[model samples]
Target: MKKLVLSLFIVLFVFGTSLSQIRPVYAAENDFTFTVGSNGATVTDYKGTDLNVVIPAAYAGTTVTEIGRSAFDTYGTGKPKITSVVIPSSVKVIQTYGFRYTSLTSIDLPDSLLTIGSSAFENNPLTYVEFPDSVTMIGNYSFYMNNLTSIKLSENLKTINGGAFDTNHITKLVIPAGVTKVDSSSFYNNNLTSITVLGNATTFGTGVFAGNPGNLKIFGIANSPVYAYASSNGHTFVDGTVLFQAVVSAKSLLNSHLAGTGVGQVPANTYNDLSAAYHAAMIFVDGIGNATIASDLDNAAIPLTSAISAFNAEIIKAGNPAALVAAITAAQQAMTNHPQGVNVGQTSAANRSTLQNAITAAQQIFNQAGQYLQGELDVAVAQLEMAIDTFEDVIITAGNPTALGAAITAAQQALTDHPAGVNVGQASVGTRTALQTASNAAQQILDNAGNYTQDQLDAAVNQLNTAVQVFNAAVIQAGIPTALGAAISVAQQALTDHPEGTDVGQASAGTRTALQTASNSAQQILDNASNYTQNQLD
Candidate 1:
């Protein structure tokens, strides 16, 4: 009976019994019959002029098919009004601004409702809503500013359009598994405890779920898509993946560009988005503050405006846009206003006090790249140590000499390919001259070391490891890998162990002799790199 009544009433409402103006449905009231017989249907335009409107079920005999635009925008304002309304299920389409910004305190949407377009009930006083799986979408801001205590999405629903629930006052809600997304702020400032993302729902657009309920927390839906889509930035990401480090690191890389010089090797993490699109966003709250980064963000495939729009929508959906923006700006401003983009998101005394003390102990590395490029022997030694350490971790499992060799080559190139003569310290006439000789010798030895015996490889590895310990007495003496002299020892052993294998002794002897020379040369590069640090200390 209830279903039938709703169906027939809306049918007549569209065709009209209003003769003048039409209004939205009354709260929980469906007084007429279900079936509209079909008269040619009375003519009525549905702009905001109507007051206490009612549509008879069997209006002029035609079953109503559509509800017009702005059917109730500004309806019943300036009065304790909105006496009554009746809608028949025959009405299939509800247009934009329909029944929105009215004095409606409460209303029952019939189960027959299929579609409600954009801004339909924004600024209304509706306290509660129950979506029927039959309804496919609630357009952007359709229920924004409603005073609902809670909402429950219909299980059969496949799509809930963007901004469908921004700024509502719901305390709790359940998202049906069928929902592929929860557009920003669908529950913006409600009392929602948490949103239970269901089914295969994967993505949450930026700003989509932010500030929905102060207590609202996001949880992975069981069987939820591993990679969820970000509607704002449109990035498809795995759930629970950490991106703050990546975002901030990229910003730090961009920060170097601000100095307009000395921007070194790009961190691998910033290769993709350290561009115009990411920076152009007014969301400079995250360390992308300068105009240069903003221009870069503007030129990217995904514009900065859109990412923020998407995220803004999330904020709008949780609370009123005006309120959400203020809160977000406050939070963002507090973070970026600090120096170095360091501790970016850490606001408050607890963070300020604790972080200052802790960060003092942090060390800076790689910034001394120029010192290494200058062929400072210390820098070369350090580079070798780094390469070897990274290689051991790789070789222990993948025992591939080719891979280890490639790693070494990269380390060497860090110095050779450097544009400046000396990347590390103040160079005098002597060290500059020394640099060229050392570079040439080191390159030749590394190039020929492939034919080296196991003894040389082992010796090189040990030497590199010892070099990292700056205070190690062994490293301070004659330098590392160079001091090993593995080539000579291995060659002698080969001759003693394989007396008859002509190939073994011959190969060992040639390699050992070459290594002895190369070891002495490598020691010289180490001494050069260290000179810069010594100067700085002095």
Candidate 2:
């Protein structure tokens, strides 16, 4: 008896745990979206042409995964407009071309996300971004055409896809040392005035800066042979050129800075003019690879004094040590030279070579990944085209508008041709108006029931009506796994063709309407729908 009781208790416990795991994931369903699918964490919905979404980390009644694709499509009016958005970390895969043309000012991503899909958030109005260290793969065109004046990338980022932030607002650039390729058009058409590479920057593609000003300044690793092609455009050459400029305007900056690190050191108004001139000179001098005191700090009083005291002393000690060293130390104490550390020293101290090498590596990795996905893309594109063709055939073959139920299968196949990472825009779809016209015609045929015998007329009209209901139900039932399964199959087949290219999936709006028509037809023929209640079955 005791054993049986314990066994029953264990079964109940397991059942409770299973139920807990099956919690519902809510989303703003079909009212605004066309396709909602299972992603890693947050369920994703696609509806708008170019998906625009505002992902709220939490919603009271709505599931946090409520942002739908094409939910903000703008439908030729342009992108959807939004003030700001806070993306949840739970979102791992943001699909390809997602948020392509939206008017969002800013976005903040959470840590849980690992992959940001290709071309995701391509043309947003984001001005500033600070990527988390956890992000490794940055998809193609992820930040292209943004209004970013400044950005701080994560150190561990491995790959950056093509056209990443192509037309940004940054004036100066300091690409890190870990990145490999600074991909083609990655920084094209920007207001870039200065660029300094950190390390051995190699493998730059053709016309990387095709139309930019020839006078643009470029700085790279010392003795680093990369970017020799830059000279072809008459680009200005600086040994270590790129510098990280603050994105924020001076008005937002505090006027004060703590100075002096030792016990006797005192905090000074380091942001004042006194520090300005000193800091300027420190950066002006290209003093790398030399033991001598060559620095931009010659114009700064404090820095010049410090340099004289330090450099001259070292030289003096090896020669006329005693008197010269004492004189230099005294001069520094009197603030004879504007402190060099405040001026040119600040800029020159940074090693541009190391950062450049990093940027190169990251780019290389991204290109490699792209290479892997190329073949996949080719097959997927072809399959998508075929799916559309097949669907059109079905619609044409069913000459009798009342028999339009078969179009649903063709449309489903069309969607399957290219599943995820694809968009069902106007270009890839058939005409919804045709389907609607057919639907109307079929209904008209049913309405003219008095011309035939009771059973014959009823059978014809009932089947026609059922076909219409089925079509309608299909559009409504597109969310159901059964209907979506057939659609995804075509897309998965496309994926196999592109074993080398990236995986992409698409859902067509035209096909969606056709399926809805079939569902509506089926419902009318049956006189009732099993899935919907009386209020909906009608």
Candidate 3:
């Protein structure tokens, strides 16, 4: 009789509804349905119909430690509905499918929570989620099909299983540095504009961004795993410092034009008149506050208007009607060549408006014998330069050195072909040479692959392994383990394809040892990527 009763209980436990009869323990005082277990207590089912449900920290003096599987799933019956949930600090685990297919638009998870079971909050309408620092693991499909626009990951987060944040409206993300392992599909099909990974574990599974747009910008330290992965896989790697420097350079180039002899062979006295405004701009740019780089840049750009006004007055006094017409024509030309062309989006539209305003203002003054100052032309050119920098940032994020090299070569060839239109100066020559050199280095490794002796392949593998160390360090710093997973996989496969002992020699033994070490390092990166700390892996 006991055996038969046990069999029936097992069947009932496997299905959710039967658990209610086994414990009829409703803490009427607390108005919650819970069952006591070895550890403490778990909320098995909710009895309230409030759209905003708050799970209590304790019921009947036992801390509510878990939310049972499918505890809040409506099962498509819609008998019970909830729009928001507040999880308490005492609850540690949320079991699988606990909140799946709900109308929930908001949720509050406490730091005490450690794991979120698969599909726990899938198909919700959540716009944002803030993971508490205590969270370690987020299961597969946990946040799948949500309308998430943003997510705040915990510093201690370890593993993010496949499809964790797939199909969302996420525009930007910062993967915490501690994350070591990420399933390739974890972020699949998301609208990601930028993703910054703190770590570089390289065992990325195939199709990591399969359904997502390919224009994702990856930011990380130079010579890091993020760089290697992005470079190898043809994603743009935004070198943080380099990009900032480019911004500074663009501003400086604009400033240089305003510094000396007011634009284009002006009357001798005009220089002195523009000097005051020029000096002010220089001082402002030099002592620019460090509140925010972009804002500071804009602040520095403001004084350029004063310099242009001073120059315009000079043109009016000189009565240079022809120069005024030329200035207006230049502004029109600038408006025509606006850096961001058609179909570029809202930012481009705004830029276009600003450019048009500059042109329109110049034109209004043109009929009054107003000449366009060099400062005004410089400002327009500066805006175009900034736009070019933006394009460069995107290209860097694309991270394909081969394509960059090809583009560089094509540009150089174009200059050679159209010598009259294109000026291939010293700077251009230097840039071309540098690009060619880097391209040759990368291409040599790829081009000679078929002819590589076993020993040569071993050398190449060693070099790649060295690159991996840099990636690992950056990954740990960034704390994103899954970041490097795919890169490591590709790199390791390349090394493994080379046969052993095909070209064993006097130095082959040493190469073999080195290869073994590299192989071990690669494996370690994969093994500890998702959850293990460096100390644990070491």
Candidate 4:
């Protein structure tokens, strides 16, 4: 009887412990049903009416670390009304069918998530999904039969099981560098346009990209395993290395010449050319995994490299715009110095307009970056200098007109003092006419100062002054006999006083000879009085 009692007790204890181990410890918190485990709690089910649910990170003082199978799936009692769900960061694993056959249009996967069980999100209306870097394993048909148009796989993801992303609308894919294996039919039966494999040694199972487009492009390094696979599988293969290098070189060139107003800056035309080539190359680079042919990439790479080389060569031949820029600055300063207006000492409006035009043209040339030719820049500088000179001359002549006015006044006064006539003491008609003509011309110039240049005004002033001097010299003063006339009168008096015959109280033979000689000399001088002045006679 004692042995039987001991065996029964032992069986009961064993049975009790097994039952305890098998039966989950259930708890409820915030509309979540959790099964407590050794490490933490697992969310088993949600009994809520909210369309957008947020699973708690902890329940009953235990961290929720896992999502149990069929936790929100379309089982006997389904929660198909949930359109979106927010999984907490504490949850690392989602077991099979955790959210399968639900109305989940979107699901927020945390970065702490590690494993996604088979069919975890199968047959839903999801349009987009992205796996976090912490996720490594993706079970078969994990996102199968969905409306996923785009999916971003984790960079750290290693295994993509069969049918993991099958029967979706994925058009392009970039396999991460860390991915090692893609299982059979991993991305099958979709509208895939291209796939870029970053790793050269990544293995692909059969039918990994089956039922995609026939002309689908596979981009990778030249002669890589992915390339060989693409060739053997009757798919188009493109080597992206050359194009990538071309892009890098183009970017480097662009960065090196980004300064707008300094040494080594690129010309606008050349910079625009480089920009066009770089953009074209980027188009191919951006389309590496999508519809980009190898020949097209090759074409773009050659031009892109050529563009970079061309920019470098252009830099070597870039002309200096500093001279032109300085000239423009000087021209502007001159314009400021001689402002346009009708006031005295100010530049005329017309001259200022011309100078401003020239300055504008020069400025345009200066803004041509380093592309302007030396000849063109020199021409611009010359034109601006000419304009400045002209402007200053006008300001000096037309702007002030003081010298011209004074000259005209002096000439008029001389005319008033010396009237024109053929009389003995009056000015000669010819000299008076000449003086009047010069004075009239000068007066006209002074009256219309804006119409004449500084040179014209100066010439007029000089001519008028010369006329006045000539008129003054030509005039004979009253009672002041002409030099030849005075000499004749003295000679006549001597001749009358001293006769040539021998007479008492008369001059001797030598005196008579001297008087005759003096009269003859005076006669000669009187005959040519037109050539002698009063001072010469005296």
The C-alpha RMSD in Å for every predicted model, in order, reads 35.2, 49.5, 47.9, 18.5
Residue 255 C-alpha lDDT in model 3:
41
Candidates ranked by lDDT: 4, 3, 2, 1
2 against 4, candidate with superior TM-score: 4
Lowest lDDT sum, 10 consecutive residues, model 3, at 418-427
Tens digits of per-residue lDDT for model 2 on 255-289? 22223422222234432433453344334422222
Candidate 3, 1-538: lDDT as tens digits: 9999999998877776656556422223254578899877888776566656777778778888998888877866463657777777888999898898888888888879999999999898999999999999999889999999878887688888888888888766766557766676787888875666645452354455556557776654467666776687677766543332233333333444333443334454554545554555444432322122434444544555554555555542223445445655665565564456332121255655655665565556554433445455445445544544443333211112343334334544433432231121222344444444543453575454444433444554445444333322233221355545665666556456544565643334466567667767867766655444544333
Candidate 4 per-residue lDDT over residues 81-189, each given as its tens digit: 5677778898899999999888888877999999999999999999988899999999999999999988788868899999999999998887765678889999999
Query: Which candidate has the top score in lDDT?
Result: 4
Candidate 2 residue-wise lDDT at 119: 62
- Number of the top TM-score candidate: 4
Q: Give the total clashing residue pairs for model 3.
A: 40
User: What TM-score should be assigned to candidate 3?
Assistant: 0.39
Which portions of model 3 miss their true places by more than 4 Å? 1-32, 77-79, 222-225, 240-538
Clashing pairs in 4: none
Q: Per-residue CA lDDT of candidate 1, range 1-538, in tens?
A: 9999999999888768675475444322132223233323321333323445454433445766545566455555332234345556556556687677767766656666677788877887788777766776677778888888766566566666667787777654455545665566555565655444434543554466556433344423223442343223332222221122223333444554332212233333333334443544223322221122223322432443343333323221111123223333343343344323212122345443333332221112222333222234334334434432332232212122443354345434433433233324223344333444444443454566544444554454444333322212211122233323354456446545544434734445565556556645544554554443332222
What TM-score fits each model? 0.33, 0.36, 0.39, 0.43
